[model samples]
Target: MANATSGMAVNDDCKLKFLELKAKRTYRFIVFKIDETVKEVIVEKLGEPTQSYEDFTASLPSDECRYAIFDFDFVTEENCQKSKIFFIAWSPDTSRVRSKMLYASSKDRFKRELDGIQVELQATDPTEMGLDVIRSRAA
Candidate 1:
């Protein structure tokens, strides 16, 4: 159902894919885009389980806003392997203001549909969502 306040609808594929990633490690990340003409958010890309963070970063456009989730895996100081789901709000500086505003307004509604996210990151530039930063947060 689309929320009355934002008129943003999260596609069922988004949740189904997220569940596969969170529970089965079937994907490395998922990229979401808002289709204003449809007034709905849809899956733009599904990163393969073998995809690297660099590949995930490359999936994002230089001058557009996107919502994505990365299955971040890391080892703790004690050498325990673990993973965390990262919800990223990507609004690049070069993106149009109108597109940014729409994504910003609809992010919360869309994120709420994905239940397993453990980390939330809002990045205007790549540096802000660097691996080191994600690693530190995972630690």
Candidate 2:
């Protein structure tokens, strides 16, 4: 199934369903943790309509917890009203992704700053990532 919002192609409808699951009123955000090496940081995206942090811990293969950070960097009424955008990192070996830090002047001014940086950096995957914002939440 393809995501209606982000336009990403989901492998199946089940993933789409999971992505569309409604958020709770008291939705939790990111869980930030540092691994033993502490050279890198991990930020797990967590919230309602999916497994809780406690549940994830119970199911994790290693007792060592994976750290993550949540960034509701882009949430708008035009988008899914209850939606949040998160950037989570587990390890350098885990994924290429990094911290949840958004180096904007302020939260309200992130989009503009992001656009400026995008142009400055010449992002290879530059297709306007608000759609990815939805796709990541689905996973």
Candidate 3:
């Protein structure tokens, strides 16, 4: 997992890698969109979400946005470990999908069960998904 305090830039490659991991089922992910059509598509693609936060909100560096947090889980082989994936969907308009963000981490990192299952979860902060942090750097 990357360090949240390091101020890393999110890029297309990272997004692509996330999608690839989702496809491979290496980790689970969720989609947050107010549009019913888009939500339906996401449900069809990713299956029903494990949890949903309809009234979620986050404070960004430049502004505050009302968003929804969709959560999912991925259990490692033999139910050894669990991973939590969160998808943050910012809906400034409340009528469509606008800004999409993603965060994923393991439930536990430094511990393993007697069966030799290790939990390798990552830590993240909402500020890392702030618009100023995610905006195109070229500008």
Candidate 4:
């Protein structure tokens, strides 16, 4: 998820470890931090985080700046079909580490798809998020 504020869509082509954006001079990658607990929660809450490879590729981004897609593949599927009934811890020590770090799930609301991973966290728009601004002329 790229928390995009404008009408930008990820190019539906190309498959690489990372995505490069030329327009805004940025780059993104599909990174995954395997958490058995988080995976289980996803399957229960969002219904199976794993999607068909075809579907995943269809939402990929081309070598353009418009947008990029981060595809996260599951190396293990032990909790793929299970629900939150299990003693799963989503955040784990991951949350205690830092608060500013933005991961895949953190950007879900802004992101369009569920399978892709967002290696680079998008910049937060001040106006959109609603924050007071005070500007002063140079003394």
Candidate 5:
């Protein structure tokens, strides 16, 4: 497993790059574990999330892991269009976790995120995921 410092460095690099692009109207975000340390950083950067979900654990075909999703919204002043930011956390190992972020303005991209997870779940034990897991937690 990678050291905590290295993991944090990776997260920081991604966060910095996201901010740089965000200033130019490009919003790109990366996901990382949500430990106490990371939680503080996230709150500082994006303020409170519009919505957040608790950890959902499941036994995947390849491994057992926990997942959580967070959503943040930014409304453009000119058009009041809402741009979405999604942060997904995946922990394949109890001791190590990683995450991914999606910045989207279209419904298609949002559907794609859910579709990807649905496919993964289908490959594993579907019962491991609650019926309302994705809809209630993510949407």
Candidate 6:
């Protein structure tokens, strides 16, 4: 569904892929991009279940705005393994202003379409969403 506030639509594939990730653990992460010409949010990349966090990080462009969801697994201080679904808004400083604005505005609506997100993070650089930060949040 598209939201008038953001002037962007979330493709059905976005939600479908999210469900697949959340329910089946089929993906380690999913990156979403707003297709300017289409005025809609679409799946730009899917990280394989076996992909590492570094691989997911590499999939993002340095000068672009993207939405990503990562299935982060970590061990708690109590020695229990747990996973948290992280919803990340990637808005690099080098990205186009228009792109950044559109993504920032559209993110919430797009995120709302996907259920079961346990953590929400907005990052302008890699360090902001680093493994350490994710681990802390998962804790």
RMSD of each: 0.7, 14.7, 16.8, 19.8, 14.1, 0.8
Enumerate residue pairs that collide in model 6.
none
Per-residue accuracy of model 3 over 1-139 as CA lDDT, tens digit each: 3224322223233344345444554323322222223221111122233322221222221232222222334445576554333344332322222222221111111011111222222113454444343232112
Q: What TM-score would each prediction reach against the true structure? A: 0.97, 0.22, 0.20, 0.18, 0.26, 0.97
Error of 1 at 10 (Å): 0.7
lDDT string for model 6 (1-139, tens) is 5688888998999999999999999999999999989889999999999999999999999999999999998888898998999999999999999889999999888888999999999999999999899888888
Q: Which stretches of candidate 5 lie over 4 Å from their true place?
A: 1-12, 25-80, 92-139
Candidate 1 lDDT (Cα, whole model)? 0.93
In model 1, what lDDT does residue 53 have? 97
Whole-model lDDT values for every prediction:
0.93, 0.30, 0.29, 0.25, 0.31, 0.93
Q: For residues 22-135, what per-residue lDDT tens digits would candidate 2 score against the true structure? A: 232233333433332432223333454344434433332232333322223334546743334343222222222332121111122222211111111111121322335434
User: What's the lDDT of the predicted structure labeled candidate 4?
Assistant: 0.25
| Candidate 1 ranges with C-alpha deviation above 4 Å | none
Q: After superposing candidate 3, which stretches have Cα over 4 Å from the reference?
A: 1-27, 36-80, 85-127, 130-139
User: Any residue pairs clashing in model 1, and if so which?
Assistant: none
Q: If both were scored by lDDT, which would come out higher, candidate 2 or candidate 3? A: 2
Task: Encode model 4's per-residue lDDT on 1-139: one tens digit a residue.
Answer: 2234322222232222222221221332232232233221121111123443234223322211112232233222453531111111123232433322333334343233333332322322222111111111000
Task: Order candidates by lDDT, high to low.
Answer: 1, 6, 5, 2, 3, 4
